[model samples]
Target: MAFLLLGFALVMVGASGIRPCNLAFGADQFNPNTKSGKRGINSFFNWYFFTLTFAVMVSLTAVVYVQSNVSWAIGLLIPAMIMLISCAFFFLGTNIYVKVKPEGSPLTSVVQVFVVAAKKRRLVLPEQPWLTLFNYMPPKSINSKRPYT
Candidate 1:
């Protein structure tokens, strides 16, 4: 049982990175801003996580059955096949996945927002009490209200 649990942990952690990327890509196929598209995306996820849970349950059942009645290799391979099938589906549907044009620029965009706001001397900057106590204020009117700050 310890070995089985440790194996489960390993599989989960290994799968964690790919799960978000796949779900977001799949859901991206729908433009949730529209009513129909929103409904379609909602349907996609309803099927998505349900299928995920169903697969897990089926795999667990296979493992238990294998442990009890079948040869170890045969039992393990059943769920292994399921994983292979799931991977194939993902690959086959890859072309339909939603993609980002800016290509992983979210952080860059966020930082730029702050930089642009800070550059425009038009907002209230957050005050550092230490600076005020030490009399370290800059000469110009401190307009440093950055949302990212």
Candidate 2:
């Protein structure tokens, strides 16, 4: 019973972490700016959602029926085997997938800001604190094509 609960907790944690990132990761494969890219992304999402809904319906109905009527171990094994095959398919497409290089961690930059603030706590502040703050302006030559920029 303890092991079952522990397994359930782990699965919940894993699902929580992966679920949000899954859509973003899939969408990242296409360049959304181009017409074909936009169409591909839309199609990808449509199929992705349809399959997701279908899987849930099957799991709820078929898996539940199997668990109630057949051996509990076999019912659990069915999903496990499906998961294994899906994992295999994912790995097989590794060469074709777009590999994005990760930027530096945001948490590290946040920690550095906190550490700098703590070290500067003894400094005296001016009457207008906002005036003392530095604002960065980038050069026009370094333009970014990204929409966020």
Candidate 3:
């Protein structure tokens, strides 16, 4: 009974941590999208998988096997500790990682999508040579279906 409850609690907490940390860790990679961001992204990918699997290995195998019993509270603490450490590392790495804007944030990707769409209406008005000044491709197949609408 105790073991089952412990497992359930761990599952809940572990899942919650995984979702946001996944984003936080993901953003940490491309902090600037430049040379430094490239290096940061590379390092984050290599280290992220290594630590993730290694932590999982220790939690499932070592925690259960080495701990030797489910009669005590220690079995549960392993995951709690994992959460603690994972979250701690998230904050610890924040200065190094790119920041993840919250969902619905103006900085989010959808904001730029709106900007692009709003601007597209004007893109078609310019003549071919003038449109070329912005490096935008003139819409092809103009006679086929008038895609701009």
Candidate 4:
């Protein structure tokens, strides 16, 4: 019973960590503003869910069949081997992945925005873009089409 509880706790922790990160990592692959980027993200989500559903179906049927017909040990071994192979493939593709650094808690930043807005409510905003309180660089400054002078 203790071992079963421990396994459940570990699975919960792993799922909690991965669930929040997977969507952000996948979405980071394309810029959200551009047409192509929008399409890319949309297609990515569609395919991602489809693949997940398919994998779950396959794993359920295969694992159950193996456990019932062959041996419980071999059934468990199959998933362990698959996880090892998947991890290897993930590490191999690390160089090709777009890595995003962890910014401080997103909730903190959102609260900060609200606080800043309230504090600055009386102050008139500047007409000049550079003088604005919020530091946002225009897309033209970053995009490749318009090279910086």
| lDDT tens readout by residue for model 4, 1-149 | 99999999999999999987888788888887999999999999999899889889978999989999999999999989988998999899989888766645767767877998999889876788576656766766634342211
> What lDDT score goes with residue 16 in model 2?
99
Residue-level lDDT tens digits of model 1 in 14-44? 8897877767777768987799998998899
Better of 1 and 4 by lDDT: 4
- The C-alpha RMSD in Å for every predicted model, in order, reads 11.2, 8.1, 11.7, 9.5
Q: What digit string (tens of lDDT, one per residue) describes model 3 on residues 1-149?
A: 99999999998998997766674557554754598887877787788789878988887887887468663478778778877997899688777654444444545556767987998866656466765566665567244332211
- RMSD of candidate 2 to the true fold? 8.1
Candidate 2 C-alpha lDDT tens digits along 48-76: 99999999999999998999999789899
Off by over 4 Å in 4: 106-149
lDDT scores of the candidates, listed in order: 0.76, 0.85, 0.69, 0.84
| lDDT order of candidates, top first | 2, 4, 1, 3
Each model's backbone clash number: 1, 0, 2, 0
Name the better of 2 and 4 by lDDT.
2
TM-score of every model versus the real structure: 0.57, 0.68, 0.46, 0.68
Off-target runs (Cα >4 Å) in candidate 1 are: 1-13, 102-149
